[model samples]
Target chain A: MTNLTAQTRHHLVTARVENKAGVLLRVAGLFSRRGYNIISLAVAPTDDPAFSRISIVVDVESNLLQQVIDQLDKLINVVAITELDPEEATQAELLLATLARSVEHDADLGVLIQSAGASIVEMTDQATTIQLVAEPTVLDDFEEKLRSYGISELQRTGAVALPRLVQL
Target chain B: MKLTGAQALIKSLEREGVEVLFGLPGGAILPVYDPIIDSSIRHILVRHEQGAGHAAEGYAQVTGRPGVAMVTSGPGATNIVTALADAYMDSVPIVVITGQVATTSIGTDAFQEVDTTGITASVTKHNWLITDANDISRIVAEAFHVATTGRPGPVLIDFPKDVANATIDYEEPGELELPGYRVASAPDERSVAAAVELIAAAERPVLYVGGGVIKADAAKELAHFVGLTGIPVTTTLMARGAYPDAEALHLGMPGMHGAFAAVTAIQRCDLLISFGARFDDRVTGRVEDFAKGAKVIHVDIDRAEIGKVRRPEVGIVADCRLAISALNEQIAKNSAAQSRDRIATWVERCLDWKQRFPFTYEGAGTAAPGDIGRIKPQFVVEELRRLTPPETILVAGVGQHQMWAAQHWGFVDPRSWVNSGGLGTMGFAVPAAIGAKVGCPSKMVWAVDGDGCFQMTAQELVTASSERIPVKIAILNNAYLGMVRQWQHMFYEQRYSEVYLSPDLPDYVKWAEAMGCVGLRVTDPKDVAAAIEQANAVNDRPVVVDFRTDSMEHVFPMVPAGASNDEILVHPSQADQPR
Candidate 1:
């Protein structure tokens, strides 16, 4: 087995691909065929709408890193490929956690949400829904905070990224 | 100009320089056939859709251009599955166009409404479903482009019946926008330097060649490098003719059933310079034990293939021609010729191995009068090699005969040998031979097939006969799935399950005659050459020579499946992989 900690790590890989039918399949196919471990993938229309931007967080082995980049770069549908470095990129993901109404302390959960930098989106007799938009790592920790509240359902968007702009 | 989708597609194929198309038409593809009848592209009507597909593969293997196949929907699409899979495995370029039900009737379960593109997606490099008539030309062009570029694989374009019937304004797509496909990659300078250093320093080095040499058309450059560097070359099955078999540096083959010396050289060599060849399981045997002593310098056009199997000391992802030529220049500049004397001892050792236990079978072409009933199949192959011209492009169906053809044929240049290498598909020879003959009309072509393989696609002879494609077929009639029987005999306690077909089955000669081919049967060893001569003389029609061979014989220098190349079992009793 490959060394999980050493070989697997989150890499922000963005691909600008033709906005056409089956383009997503092609990108997904490349990932599967090449055996790259994609932690998360998000595809959406770019600003121009002529092409789609596919942001994938891959657990890329250091040895297979160049190969992964080369393979992804060669797909005809993929117009451009960029692997955003952690030092140079900003990343974000959204999480929505629906907590069951059976929580022991609803007022305490509101205080916990305020302290954890989250907001209550909906509250009803059935459930209390909380939404958090933050860095992927922050959401991962926030999920642990919601665990004691007896969350019934949870949904999280895959990480989306862009290179950080600097005035310098 | 205004044109029907079928006309536009045909025009696009012609624009892409397609000379011939192999296909079987049906209701869905009838409109396309109408345009093909009048177009400059010659259409060869095949007996089965499978034949058309394999024939196209053969054509592409020899020409380096994508073979074109056009078949109707449903059964036609499914029939091509094997051929497409074969191309996918071997990286042969092919463009298969299958017709589909009309756009409205696609999901309505109308007659012949099969999801051709969906079914073929996994097997092909890419596939398209053309619902609009306007997309016909661009789709055809892109299909050809995608099929030929990158790793070179079969691509499919599904043409719905209504789309083919619809009229639209057609303009040829000026250029394809395939951002992912890479072509003609040059080797990295550092990697080349590393490879050159290894090649220069090694006293015992071997040059391993594979099908990519032919694919990249780098045989000439490779031969030049080997000649200048005095390196011994072992060509793999797919790369049989990439270097001259008669050359002094040649090491016939280097895997299971390969020459004892060639296999030994690989095992003992200090440096193995691999060019355009993957270390396939068949060649490497047990991967852990293969080339245990050699440090491999692997070069190929595909980057992912570099360390996919055996990790190389130096891996260069570049076109074989470009890499070899650059290496040639570097070697010439650096005076790498100084090491010729150092490699002399190694060359002599390889030569001694070749001279001592050459790939030869006992009683080959020299059977006694009493042994007339037992015609050696190897002898038949040797005789075929002797009788055929030097330029003969021999294609073989997979099995014992394919090995024999590879072992005995005198291949001197690239494209002179064509076979299903990676897939090892049976029933590939007949149609492939026809396709090859069609592609290289001036050259002699022969289909060396086994009885089992012949039975699967023998109907193709009718297509060959009808089209006047005069390729010869040599059926080594052992009355069994020869290789499977040999395996059962060698390892399965001789249980011989269902390997044998009844010897009293349909006569191949009569079957050949029924298909308008000149048929002959040679029972004795002495008659082998004469029968082949007769078959060769029948230039006006296709000929089938049924040579009944001894079923007891088995291919030697056997590595047994999954055994290391070095753990060779020359005879059946010494089976290497008993487990």
Candidate 2:
């Protein structure tokens, strides 16, 4: 039997769309209709307010990536798209993990926190919150460690990426 | 000077050179209808909104203009949905204007309220909801542009009641600017060169023509290209008349129920030059194995259709006219075009297939001199084809009869045949034939319908009779959806599965008489010609001929739906007989 850990690839796609109210819905609706799961989606104002840039990370079967692009290209609101391959793009995710204060107080937790590349953002007698800013893999590892400490709250902002440049 | 949005809509249509429109007036659309009463554009009031939409399609198909339909919202809008989807599926250019509830009542679901745009979003080529009076001219212009351009499909513009009632100072619409929808340019030199290179090298090559050639108005270019290349061609169902059926180079339609020679040639060609045709499921059965031996060259106006099915060795994105013209020029320059004697054996085989499997009905040839009763559907279609002129427009209601009509009729020129090909819409013939006659008022129009299909939207004949549109209707009354029954017989253990319809129920003759049309029921085979001639003689009103045909007849040379082209089912009893 195949392992339950699903084998999928994350694709980072950036699109320029009209800043109208229904634009986002139409785009997301397309993703759902085509059966592509959006791992994370972020939209922000670009240089021109008339249009905004939407960054989406989707986990899909590798063979179906071109079909997704083709489908997206047909949507009228989408003006342009640039797909940054995982290896060619610089990527990062910001994740906040809140854990019980008992873990921080017990077993030299300060060294573990420093070594794990997590910074404390807030602390109280009962709870402790730490922020991790790093590559997606590093963030995933930190979240896995926080879950064992009986975490009270956990928030992960999906990956945001830009194409990495090599000097000419 | 300011004009209300309704007046502006009519004025804009007039400016676009629209001579007529087909529709019905209802509560939500009364404001627009008021302006239309005095406008030069003639409104052909149809019995149903679906009829109106189909009539518009018929007009567009024959005249090569964007057919226009108008209707009220809610039920009126929903009724016309089939026409929009039909036009969409067939890639026929039509613009539909519909009334919506007042702007304030849109979300509140007031009287005759429906989200017309939302319902039609997927089916339409493009759609717009009018919010301001000033937006009419631009939106109308855009709708026409989008409807007629590219692959050419239906466009709908939803006119809210309040917006139509509002007034604005209208100026002439400016230049067309479509940011997202761009008209395709001619294919680059390399792709055209590559296509020609394949054509010259292959010993067995066939030009697979389709409706896109007719849609592009490229029949002349296609003829010129084929003439210069000296290559044999096959037209699809939607492209019945795109090429002259009388020509020796013609291989007839190629698909399910298509010519044996044409389907076999597609299966065996060394190089398949697919000009302006999508390899639809019907055409390419067992998609993985279609055109097993051919190096395909797909040229279309739509880029998405290129790799959407079978990936071609060389794909060219350009208008059919430009692409074929370019290929012809390249063939003229290159020494690659093969000589006539080079592929003589293959051509001979195709000619043999054509002769061996000519579309025929049982007892059609050896009938006794004065034989009467139990008319064969193919026989009726052939009789109609022989009676009609070269320039006559033939439309069909979808069923076994539609297939038979396409197979038997010798369509001599482009834009001479119109049917619901992609959508296979039942009850398409009468209204569409009305639209065709309206578009070309001087030409003879004939609607070939099936009994099962005719019952769906036969009310449109009333519209034709009232409008004084004299067209001929030949209902092959087999008393069943013959195609469906044929399938049940072939594959489903002959269950017959609710496919039969009783003849006395509708009484087509009485139905026609009630609609103010002269109805002729022919039970005898010998009287078929005389009945058709009598129908032809009448020019003041429409005529319906209820031809009581053989109930067991089936469209042959069948691909059996999901089966491969090689697995065609020939006529059962005549399997061993020579053509």
Total clashing pairs in model 1: 4
By summed lDDT, the worst window of 10 consecutive residues in model 2 chain B runs over B364-373
Give the C-alpha miss distance for residue B298 in model 1, angstroms.
Answer: 2.2
Clashing pairs in 2: B373-B524
- Evaluate model 2 with DockQ and give the value: 0.36
Candidate 1 stretches with Cα past 4 Å from truth are A1-13, A30-39, A57-74, A82-88, A102-105, A164-168, B365-373, B571-579
Give lDDT tens digits, candidate 2, residues A1-168: 012333246778888877754567667877876688898888877889988888888777666666677667666667877788778888888888778875457566666678887888988878888888887767777777666677888898877777899879
- Candidate 1's residue-wise lDDT over A1-168, tens digit each? 124483256677888888877777767777787678888899999998888899998887666666687767656677888988867889889999999973335778878788878888887877888899988877888898788879899998888889999868
Q: Model 1: per-residue lDDT, tens digit, B1-579?
A: 999988988999999999999999999999999988789999999989999999999999887888999999999989999999899888899999999988989888888877676567657888888988988887888888788865788999999989989999998786765655556578899988888898888989998898888988998899789877999999999899999999877978988878677787898899999988889988888899888988999998887688878889999989888899888888887666436888999999898877665666656435453265677888888888888888888999999999888888878889988899888899999999999999898889998999999999999999999999999999988899999998998899998999997544879889999999999998887788789999989998999999888888788787888988877866433334221
Candidate 1 clashing pairs, residues 3+ apart or interchain: A74-B180, A75-B180, A76-B179, A76-B180
Candidate 2: C-alpha lDDT: 0.86
For model 1, the chain A TM-score is 0.90
TM-score of chain B of each: 0.96, 0.98
Each prediction's number of clashing residue pairs:
4, 1
Off by over 4 Å in 2: A1-10, A21-45, A56-64, A90-168, B175-177, B366-373, B573-579
TM-score of chain A of each: 0.90, 0.86
Task: Please name the candidate that would achieve the greatest DockQ relative to the true structure.
Answer: 1
